[model samples]
Target: MLRLDDLTLFTRTAELGSLSAAARELDISPAVASAGLKRLEQQLQVRLILRSTRSLRLTPEGEQFLAHARSALHSLESGRQALAGGKAAISGVLQIAAPSDFGRNVLLPWLDQFQQAHPQLSLRLLLSDHVADLFRQPVDIALRYGEPEDSSLVALPVAAGNRRVVCAAPAYFAHHGQPRQPEELRGHNCLLYMLGGRVHDRWSFVRGGESQALTVSGDRVSDDADVVRRWAVAGQGVVYKSWLDVAADVEAGRLQVALADYRGEATPLNLICAHRDQLSKPVHLLREFLQQRCAELLARVPWA
Candidate 1:
């Protein structure tokens, strides 16, 4: 008989491209994961993966089985949830990923309250500016901004109305003067943030059926989005950031919006999963909680 554990190990190894990584996620030793994969291949009588010291790649047979394996897991999970009346306690550790700034400034306190509400549920959060590979990473879900480019992942709206804003500290504006229009931002110092090796210095906006873009320059730059926001709050330079990220700062009068009439880029927040099967009751509830919290936060300001 085939073991479900073996199937899970095989699928995770294929997705992560590392037996060790999959084992770490599943809370098993690398040797155990390797042995499980070997047992599974032996039972199926096919070469599943071409393994090497420094690399791991799925063979054609493994590639074909991967789809079926994921489907099977999904079906089993669905059955289990259905059997539990969809009221299963949201226990176990949920691994999540989010942007650095939002994770620290916004999500941290919210998650704390959420965990308090569900004492049985634990959270593992990965904070980064770079996008996480939903298929490859160990994270069960990710909180991201903007519409997801990959169609395979399931995206649930957390804050669909969220948008970017151009803002800076009052001290900086007092010294450099605030721009009344989008185009005038060219004369001010703009804090730049880099992601996936590209510097986001080009500020774009739209207002009254007109569109404008400006390539602003600044003395400070950081790959970490949180650092850029901090620089803006410290009066270092103007920043083009997600309103959800800077909403509290703006509300507290630490930062002031520039060119509020012009609408900046849309940055709709979402909770994304690699597979629909991953959307358990906990995930759905988390999405709703996030939506409400985000709505409340944005309501404090008229920027939404």
Candidate 2:
């Protein structure tokens, strides 16, 4: 009844000669490695390792287990690599769902390169703000802006440290006079973006080492984010949005940033799959490619 992960850890610890060393090599915390080893020992009703103040020595039984476990782990790893390796020749229509603005502005161009790299792979891009049901929809994967609430799907990191910004056109800021903090948003006309049939007017931020949220009011609301961006650029009102989406406009001086002191909440980007076992070689390639590209794009922004 030894856990597969614990067995892998046991072999790693045996090879490294120390639990902490194995943890470092495996990119896991020492406490987790220690607990995994303890779990393995308890399951087998055998003392696998003897721990000292500064070192680790395997019990006689542990040494015997290590030999068999190492061989088994190698076999399992070879099988996994084979599956991953089969991805080199991906030929099929890979369907991916993404948010409307990001999909159009960022992902569409990226997909063009991906198609070039894998000539045999046909692709279908589904763009919408509505969250796709991975289990029900005909989608192989999805790129999303925030953590999914559904426990059934696996969220893989595409990009991290993506923060939103509160901004407006220079003309609007000049007419209204820019208010300083998050609280001042109430005095201005805030642009609202509709998602899932509801208006998202609550803007979250961090001010003075504490988390704060403000429910903003505005004269205009639109389901299409691009429309909201357009309205903001036309000197209509303040808008809260992903910095990356507005990075070009902000840089081009189309919009001016507000509340520079308040830090916007980080909205991580993720590539989600319904099940790891269902992941094919194309999926693996796409996931890795986007992970790299998305990080690069997020890092392109310069903010105060």
Candidate 3:
């Protein structure tokens, strides 16, 4: 008989595309993952993976097994949920991933409140600017900005908000003069976010039923959004950031919105989770909590 634990490991490895990545997600050693897969394949008398030094691929047999394994796992999860009913209690560590600045400013305070409400629950929060692979990381849910490109995972929109106006310190605007059009931004110091190994220095704007893209350059750049916000606040350069991060400064007259006519639309925040039927009670509770908090906050903001 095939072991359920071994089958779970096998399914996770196949979904994640690597034994080491699966091990990381499962909080186990690669050796354990390898042994589990070996045992699983041995019990079935079939080759499952075409292993290589640098890559992993599922064999035909493995592919077939994966479909069945996923379905079975889903069925098992559904049954468990049905047995527990809707009032299942939660008590476990819930791992989460979120952007560094957003997590620090928005979610951290709310998390304190959430913990107070549920003392039995613990949380492990990972803050990063780049998107994390949920199947390769030990995360129960991920808070992502913008829509996810991956079709395999399930994404739920939690917060509706917009990108901030292109803004700078009063000093920087006085030194460089304010830009009237998107094209004029080329003459000013513009900060950019690097995406997908490229410096996204191009700014998009729409006015008078037309759209334009402005190419910009700057002497200072960093991957952290908070660093960019700090530089802009200190009169170092102009930056485009979420209003949530700069709203306080804007209200305090520390920073001013530049080229307000060309501001872009808001990007919605999303809660992402693996597409699985057996979500634990803790995950469900946290997801609902986040959604409720996000909704309440967005209600008070104009851009949201």
C-alpha local distance difference test of each model? 0.88, 0.82, 0.76
Better of 1 and 3 by TM-score: 1
User: Which candidate gets the maximum TM-score versus the true structure?
Assistant: 1
Error of 1 at 267 (Å): 1.1
The weakest ten consecutive residues by lDDT in model 3 span: 295-304
- The best candidate by lDDT is 1
Q: Candidate 2 regions off by >4 Å?
A: 1-88, 302-304
Clashes of 1: 0
Rank the models by lDDT, top first. 1, 2, 3
* Residue 93 error, candidate 2, Å: 1.2
TM-score of 1: 0.87
Candidate 2 lDDT tens digits, 1-304: 7678898788767756778888998899989998998888988899989999898888899877765675565456446757767645677668799988788877788899999999998998888888987653556689888899998778888787788889999999999999888888999999999988999999988877899998999899988887898899999999998876787788789998887778897878888976665466677889889888877766765445
Ranked by TM-score, the better of candidates 2 and 3 is 3
TM-score of 3: 0.73
lDDT of residue 167 for candidate 1:
96
Tens-place lDDT per residue, model 1, 10-129, is: 988887778999999999998898899999999999999999899999888887787678767766876776687746676766889999999999999999999998898889899998
**Model 2 lDDT on a 0 to 1 scale:** 0.82
Rank by TM-score, highest first.
Answer: 1, 3, 2
Number of clashing residue pairs, candidate 2: 0
**lDDT winner, 1 or 3:** 1
